[model samples]
Target: MDLQQMRYVVAVAETNSFTRAAERCLVVQSALSHQIARLERELGARLFERTSRRVRLTPAGMAFLPAARQCLDAAERAAAEVAAAVGEVRGRLAVGLIPTVAAADIPGALLGYRRKYPHVRISLRVGASEDLVEQVKQGSLDVAFLGLPPTMRPEGVAAHELARDRLVAVVAPDHPLADEPAVSLRRLSSETFVDFPAGTAGRIQSDLAFSAAGLSRDVAFEVTTADYVTRLVGPGLGVAMLPSAFAPQLTGVVTIEVTDAPTRVEYIIWSRFGHTPAAAAFLKALDIT
Candidate 1:
């Protein structure tokens, strides 16, 4: 019938005495007796056989005892799971990211988080800033990294600026422009460029940088990944522009500072929906506290 009735049935079955069971349950003897009687009536079966001096189980009581105990155990487990989902720092965490952040400090931060909490399951997804935002909003990801432009405000999601990585020019190690210690947008106006697709976050940065210098970037290729820009540049395919951090890991590519006033802002973006322990730990290690 109810949890109290089930508990009374278990107590009576274990103690085999209404008086002792009432004492164990911290209820009056009459209350315990009434609860068990109500349960038997609801079940349409005699659960206990009682004499003036002794108490024993009917076939029904024996059958019902284990099920009653199981119900109580299940109820407790449900509560524990809800609590774990709310506050505990363990479980599966799906993270999404824009290319630059994924290629930079995020991997190292995740490695540190894995060392600290080896049991938490972690998964990563890569997309543009706006796409990652949509994934988080749709519950496809728990956290993400983004670089929001001045025109964009991350809606329905929590965001924090983790770092500011300046933009740079990347070229094949032996390319003529690679010899410059640092180059300006004016110097790059004539170079064939490899860049992000027309309407993505990285492309917005490139467009803004060129606009600020009143120069047009010559387009020879369009791609989606920052790493591909590196690999393409290695073959002297064309010059690429990307975040400075992204260039460090790219062998056969030379990184030169873009002598421009504007730099892209890198951020640790995540859904306001919440974070699993592992994702939160990785964010903390990134100094996003």
Candidate 2:
């Protein structure tokens, strides 16, 4: 019935626990529960099914969540628009990026944005390129930095190219390829490898190149984080191919050029139609059109 009550319900649905939702909403458990109970009574539906160990949304809650989120977004957007009309940028800015992103100094950029727009709320999420792009498209993230193969493009979002670079092979010091000045995919394919999980944007870059060369390699370890990939490679267990710019940042590994290396492109993506004032201002401040 009221925004506050709706917020409590939404928080409970998201967190899946009344106690956690209360903490997120900055209210006591009893008050949040009472408000949501009153709202449920007014609507003639039970929103959540509570158990001793967990909470789950009921059918009615599932149907109500989307509309509740839309209402909250609309209210926030209205206030942001009013502030924009007054030459002020004040709203939430949720940014997402891959952990291996090096196209921009994300931390420094966030620091600058915070300094310039002290009234805005800023949050960051480090995740996979695909997940980050999807988050931006869904409007949960105001902006995202992504890395994908040159042949790929993010669908249903506005993106700007940041930088492009070829990949290099990383090997442990005692590995056979470490002493080599350069190597080919056919050579590296014969050795076991450490790489991102198959089918991910990070792994696909190398896969495409090997496929183009009519070669297949074994990924002995498939890890989500680049640091883990490097850590595995450092033990002489396997080799990896990583962005040329990012390879130098990791130690205990020798970086070697690949004759037919795959190229990766970095991009910054945002919602085409759902740009919050804070997102717009942050982009403008960074000279990203």
lDDT per residue for candidate 2 within 232-289, as digits (tens), equals 9998989999999887689888999999899999999999885988999989977997
lDDT of 1 by residue, 1-289 (tens): 9988988888888888999999999999998898888888889999999999888999998999888887875564455456567765556567888777733466776777778766667799989888888877766677888875554567888888766677788889898987888888888888989988888877887788788778887787988887788778889989987777666667778888888734677666676866545556667776666
How much does candidate 2 score in TM-score?
0.96
Task: Note the Cα lDDT for every prediction shown.
Answer: 0.78, 0.92
* Model 1 local distance difference test score: 0.78
Q: For candidate 1, list the clashing residue pairs, or say none.
A: none
Evaluate residue 8 in candidate 1 and report its C-alpha lDDT on the 0 to 100 scale: 89
Once fitted onto the true fold, the runs of candidate 1 whose alpha carbons sit more than 4 angstroms away are 1-88, 102-104, 149-151, 276-289
Off by over 4 Å in 2: none
TM-score of structure candidate 1:
0.65
- Candidate 1 lDDT trough over 10 residues, lowest sum: 73-82
**Model 1, C-alpha of 67: deviation from truth (Å):** 32
